[model samples]
Target: MLKKAGIAIGLLSVLTGYLIHHPIPAKVPDPWLFQILTDVLAFSELMGTISERVGINRWWAYPGRLPVPRWMNVPEGMKIEKTVFHGIESVVVTPKGFAERKIPGPAIVVYHGGGWVFGNIDSYLPLLVTAAEHTGFLVMSPEYRLAPEHIFPIPFEDCLDTTLEFMSRAKEFNVDPKRIAIAGDSAGGNLAMAVTVELVKRKIAGTLVQVPAMQALIYPKLQMTNYLLPSYAQNREFIFSKDLIPKFWLSYIGLSSQYSLAQIICENAHIDFSNKQMAEKFALVHEDRVPTRYKQRPYNATPQSIPSDVKKLLDGKTKAYLNKMMLDERIAPLFASNKTLLHLPYTHVLVCEYDPLRDDGIILFERLQSLGKESSLQHLPNSLHAAASIGPFDKNLYHAKQNKILFEKVRDYLNNMH
Candidate 1:
């Protein structure tokens, strides 16, 4: 009995040591707790890799499939329900006494982020519930389909369809059609922007009835063409490392089998910057649009050589297919023209200094300003990626504080729209 107890204690100590020493590059205000969470995330990823080798290919989707407990506590002053909005599985949260309002209330449709692969509405309960209580706006979060199963257009379609159907039936939900806003973070933020741009196009074509009041994107990964932006290098090892993002992007677009392509992309050799037309297509994401303060770390634009096998692989159909997909405006809204952007509604962009996608948000805000569009930017110098979505699940006091600040800022912006 004594020997067995010693073995168990020894194993526990080893695990505790590994988690404590896990390398998290970002100097977040809450270091110990963040390290624990990062290890959890990395372990999930490692399991996905191991499962793939063993032919249990869908293990990555396990997180999305896990049951969200029905008894999970709702935020104070909020009421929550699981409902279907136009055939999409969703979660709805409304503030108490919302039904008694004399006027039709505002509503916001939020898409949850899990890098296009795993997050579901259940995982985002705290974020949605808090937003409902703080903003008094009816909040609807859709359980969009996951990738490596549904792929790009399907997830995008679900978000767009849910938004359109919600608008057309706003009276049923007691919402003002013109007062609804669309918002999301990370991959969901990418979907929100794409959906917003599509709505603008439909309006121009005399097809859209109710345009969204505004779009709020939180640290969205906007473009796949340029991964060498200053933030990619400056905060590469921050919560979401430079090496991991490409894998997410590849998996989303049904290109996971082409994993070797990640190397070509990180080096910025996938698209030829020398070609003026291609350069012009991605002009919005250029490093020049990023501000001087953001470029604190020196960035080298020099191209790195691709391995012989990868170079050979890219010389055929994969090359053409990738270029076409990367430049598709529907997939990468940052590839949209000035004319399309001018039609967009007021925009709020939130970026964190230690996020790898920081430049994506800043450049987007800069482009919107150049088009004379109404836009606002909120930059959190001490925060890391995924801070806002940490919401009520935050274990540390500092993350909880940041989550409150983020939601309150978003709430104030949406309220002003009214």
Candidate 2:
């Protein structure tokens, strides 16, 4: 009995030693793990605050989470005009008075990103005004309804309808409808791609009257699948967390209840084999495209078996909008057919190196190249997602310079285009 007890103690000691040398997963649900995660997140938030306080960073934090510095305000030279168009209220901003620039020029239909839940035209007025001034184009910023209150197709429809109306009255606004560009950041970028897709599909069916001459997608949310991509893993704790992403999607789709969100997160809801197959095909990213440095981390994830209920949801229209083939190509504009791509006019994409969405832009650029599409890419090495929305005060000299370069590139692209 004493020998057996000694053997048991020896085994316990070995197990304890192994645990000491090789810690359990940080994501474990123990109370100690939760405390560590909370402390780490709090420290990250505090560091972000210090970075912004010293003018070394310009990340836009969630409201009440971070204090907005005074320097982030709009500059004095920008002229903001508040007006309602087609029952959608919006704000139009120009760098110079209308009289200062007497002649008509190119125009941009701008959309703001808020994960489809927050954000409005006013949030990005500074960037829009700057783009208009630098490109010498009339900028029209539209306001769209947030989700939960108005789910799925509502935001997409509002943007499409606004664009149609804007194009119809292009002449009245002293703009060239033929040279108009559609541009948006983040969720807005998703809408921009969706709008273009709808336009192309309609054009094929002879329903839509007009389509933008160009599209600028800044850090767009390209697909709902492949949530386990390298970027998602590498930047899981990024300003935008992987968990928070699904939360936003739930809120946008009117499933804000914690139980519903938890069901989706736990993969307990409807999901089927066919849906998994479709997602795999749609999210098939080339191994070579992903940077080598990012792949060095240890990741041992297994393919999840889709639940029958989830599969049913996938088959339904509620989640049908997220199918890989149909909605995938539509969402990931880069995956569109060459025939569709070739028809697209001049395109400019802005990517940020530190952002999880950076590779999405890169892959899209490569896809455009392969299809022989006219495209220009501006890569911002230091910027993060949604950097442009925070305005000039949040920007440093380097960011401003990069922004200028991007604006100039867009201007040159628009100027050279017919």
- Which run of 10 residues does model 1 get worst, by summed lDDT? 57-66
Error of 2 at 395 (Å): 6.7
Off by over 4 Å in 2: 1-78, 97-103, 258-271, 275-335, 394-396
Q: What is the lDDT of residue 327 in candidate 2?
A: 43
Tens digit per residue, CA lDDT, model 2, 1-418: 9999999999987774443332223433232433333443444444444554565422234321244232234445666687766778877765555435566667778888877866666556667767776676778888888765677768877888888888888778777777788888888887887788778767877775787888888888765544555555555554423455665566565555431332354232323336765545444444345566545665433335655665444435645443422344544555566667777766788876556666666666777777788888887654556555433433444555666776677677767775
Q: lDDT at 321 for candidate 2?
A: 42
Model 2 worst lDDT run, 10 consecutive residues: 22-31
lDDT of 1 by residue, 1-418 (tens): 9999999999987885664454765557676666665676666665666665666553363455555553346766677788776698888788887766788788889998877887788777877876776677898888888887888888899999888888887777778788888989988889999999888888888994677898888888788888878888777665433546777778788987766677888877778655576778777787888989988766666666777988776775776677787887667888877888999988888898878889999999999998889998888786778777554655356666765665666667666764
Most TM-score-accurate candidate: 1
Which residue pairs come into collision in candidate 1? Answer: none
Residue 355, candidate 2: how far off, in angstroms? 2.1
